[model samples]
Target: MKFPVKNELLKRLFAAQGEPVSGQDIADEFGLSRTAIWKYIKELEEEGYEIGSMRKKGYYLIKAPDLVNAANISTYLETERYGRHIHYFSTCPTTQTIAHEEAQGGAADGTLIISEEQTAGKGRLARPWTSNAGRGIWMSLIIRPRLAPQQAPQLTLVAAVAIVRAIEDVAEIQPVIKWPNDILLNGKKVTGILTELQADPDRVKAIILGIGLNANQESEDFPDELQSIATSLKIEKGEHIDRAKLVAKILHYLEHYTALYIEKGFAPIKLLWESYATITGKRITARMVNETVEGTALGISSEGMLELKLDDGTVRGIYSADIEIKN
Candidate 1:
């Protein structure tokens, strides 16, 4: 069966909101026969959805499988626009690549590209990211915000604050933002945010924000190198989390804060980002593309740059760099 028909059928069932959708209605909507609807229902059942049918009422969703597709994710979505259009893949090279292509092709403002596993996932500086199968949240969001090319970088801070709030809402854990783009838990990395832009010199077009979250991996899931530094939500929370629910929460907050940043400014986002900031006030070493600076973290500037107070009493605002805590 075609995936669009199946996905649309699932969406109709979900939209029914527990009420049974008539088979004839579905058939007419899709211009298919009743038998075709029944076959699609069977396929959904085989895929782990427990659908129920009445005599004349047709079919209603009794249970949804633990999947990250649009059907399962829509149940938890609360936003008006974000995540309404999603591209789900069982396996893909990277959501970032797909998101970029979609953005260039004029995809919707909140179109999301999500995958169950990323074959060639990447992080900041094009580093390889581990995207374990059936675990973790590998997704990229395409947002077309009303901002200039220079102000676009502040969106990264906006997204970081949203992710922290989402973590608090879903996992009930206190995750902190390690300056720039890493979200840390208990001093270990749990999530990484990579923000890419598609814009002209004077106008802003779109921002492809790639977020990779370690959701349900055990201790052995990480490579030897990451074992000591990386951790997952299941490991930290001592249980598995519903990835779909978390994704929905993240989208909700993203939509809220993104609007907030665009309307009010970066002041509110900076305050929230600083509250969960881990590197602020700590001595750290920042390695940029050219020079390295060791300084005391001095919170983020109005432009979302990391303000580092140096030994010579100079406060240098770092625009881009990989930072390490220096105790």
Candidate 2:
């Protein structure tokens, strides 16, 4: 679903610089009534834009607001398809839920559901994700890649690489990917990626990639329980961060990696993922739903399974587990 081009009046105002664009000119160009143009200006004002009005010269654009809304993100978008359709909300229950619903309703391949706050945020295995309002990025991308259901798990790894690259580009922080989909900085969780799929055993339908990055929040912003294990970019960098720029960088890298995965297969992405992963070659224990398997991390298999060298000589591939480093 594309965010419609209803801001033509605002665009005209921007292109005119400080010069005024008359209501009659906009009305003639867009075939809209003067009353319609007034409505657009009112909407823009509500979004934090300042427009100066004169007696006869029409409307002049004064200042643009710094919002992470659709208009702001569109100004910095470089992707051809991904993130072209953004559903921006100041607060929502969850972006993942919105993305899934839109995907089922025939949304495009690169629809982005972004929310400033998520009251019911989700983590891995239904755990609660701490998504403070206006402090971090709580967004989900709806991707309809042409991969099989078996290859679905690899997308999480793909998202991890893109997120890390975005962080390095903006925050200048070196983040490590803890197998599957957790990003760590200074041994604390800084970002989280949750990949959920709606597909059968054969073909893929949609992959909802949920990413939560702690950007401008302080240590005290997080709850007491999360203060020790969670951190934000601002906390580490000791400065304020621009969330909109970071979001743009993330979408850029995400689109690049997703396209590479589609055309060149997972070989190239696997190499990039391994460079950022820290669990490999370390002694770790995989905590499963039923049993805990402890072994050395032997890296991932060709199909993206975590290969663990057990106490025995045999090596095993783990599908789902919580991996914790032992030594």
Candidate 3:
């Protein structure tokens, strides 16, 4: 259930290598029973972890599954921290919800929660985000940043830049951010981001950054409702994408930009985000929560808000909205 406790067991089992580790050793280390150890090992097997068992040899870890586990992620990450603690699930309602709960319960900054599939995933404005099982990356990052609430919106921009950079590095295709949170490839939606904040009126307590990317899904893999509007990395690149490489790159860039934002300000990240944005200087209609405004999308402000110059000779700042590019 809780991965932290299980992760410790995996670490010990893995350290034993091909040499068998006694059941008593594991029970003593984690205060779990022999039956509990057997249950956890079975659960690992279900997730594709390879374990060997003999009458006298107890249990031996033959191979670690090629999945998004804490050990695998830590090996890929060069940081002393950040993503070192990961909570993985085969299925969940949403990684965002889990991350929120963990953050509230004092989970460390940079804790990551990911799932193979999310049933009730949400996007901006409570939109249902489609996450086909074992098809894409459904993950959320828990961040505890010392920034004002006004500055918190900038994290969305930072995440967008990080994701675009990661896609370029791993997928070898330069995807562009469709201003705000959507990542597009070859004129189709490939990724969506939803940023949630837990804070007071003036300061941020924590921020949960949710990222959903269409990694290895085939065109036919998507539901009928999303077939035309959504596209996956496999569809765009004509091959399956490496989810692990992309995930590592995303975390690297996110850590970099987040540190930059804290040390300097949003100005640098805003400039970089604008450079990778595909929507600026285009005629667009922004569908806000209240109304729609048609204007030339100028650029994002230094504060990471959208700026639109309407036909009525007035400039409007859009805090949050969905944008539709005009032909």
Candidate 4:
């Protein structure tokens, strides 16, 4: 496979601090010709990077735009396992779709597929998730868990708890999980989790957990339809969020939770998930695929299914549904 010369050159240039780096220096470092280095520099400029060059003063990086390059993410992660294998795209239909394909083709566990913009992103229940270009974190992780197929649903809950914990750690905002799989901030949607599994009746082969978080979008960045219901970290916190730091925190929490779940089971993570969950012990209605069930939300079971105490003095288990907290 050919190396990404532009990415490598950018890395070296950034490492040079404010000093001007000669094209010959970059060429000798990468064992390439000066012409090749110049070509790569032109490509980087075309990608919106402002590189300043003088007749004999060498090249200076004036600005490094926040582009979601795989090498850059790997450099930020600086790890070998999780997020080490990253596939980045400028624009795609959906990161989840690409992740699913990669998982099917035997991608390593903890592989991440991220995109700067997703034109056809989807959320839970096949709802459209709007991700403005370069505005939010549109990514998916592929995990191969050694668990029973029946226990796979718990992964969604695990991801939610991890995300909530990460948000609290970095942004100081206490986000909540709305049942089945949705993260909310101040009663507005901030993050959406979708878990897709390739498994048989007994065991799971691979699981793809897709997460879409509105990070740095301004209020006007969202469409008129979503302004009232959807929110971003910037909108909620009145500041631009560091997407790379958030991604690191999330991956750290996810790695921790996955290890704990495999060792002690979902009981431990379930407790943490319930602790941050805001929907429990409230009057709500669950909109399932077949019908909507009105009930008092009790809590999630050990298997990660929502236990709803319905009317007429009965309780029911909801495997998957959309939950609305009643007034």
- Residue 102, model 3: lDDT of 97
Arranged by TM-score, best first: 1, 2, 4, 3
- List the lowest-lDDT window of 10 residues for candidate 1: 1-10
Instruction: Write model 3 residue lDDT over 248-308, tens digit each, in one string.
Output: 7789999988999899998899889989888788999999878999999889988878899
Error of 1 at 294 (Å): 1.0
**Cα deviation of 240, candidate 2, in Å:** 2.1
Q: How do these models rank on lDDT, best leading?
A: 1, 2, 3, 4
True-vs-predicted CA distance for residue 174, candidate 4, Å = 2.0
TM-score-wise, the better of 2 and 3 is 2
| lDDT score at residue 15, model 4, on the 0-100 scale | 76
Q: How far is candidate 4 from the true structure (C-alpha RMSD, Å)?
A: 3.4
TM-score list, all predictions? 0.89, 0.87, 0.82, 0.84
Q: What would the TM-score be for candidate 4 when compared with the true structure? A: 0.84
In candidate 1, position 212 carries an lDDT of 98
lDDT of each: 0.91, 0.87, 0.84, 0.83
Estimate, for each residue in 52-89, the C-alpha lDDT of model 4 and write its tens digit.
Answer: 88666578788877766664553345334668677888
Checking candidate 3 for backbone clashes, the offending pairs are: none
For lDDT, the strongest prediction is 1
Total backbone clashes of candidate 4, pairs 3 or more residues apart or in separate chains = 0
List runs of model 4 lying over 4 Å from the truth.
1-62
Please identify which of the two predictions, 1 or 4, would achieve the higher TM-score against the true structure.
Answer: 1
Candidate 1 lDDT over 1-327, as tens digits, reads: 126567778877888878898888868887999999999899889888999999988899998877888767876778888998999999999999999999999899999999999999999999999999888999999999878899988888899999999999999999999989999998889999999999999888999999999999998999999999999999999988999999999999999999999889999998999998988889999999999999999999988999999999999999999999988
Task: Per model, state how many residue pairs clash.
Answer: 0, 0, 0, 0
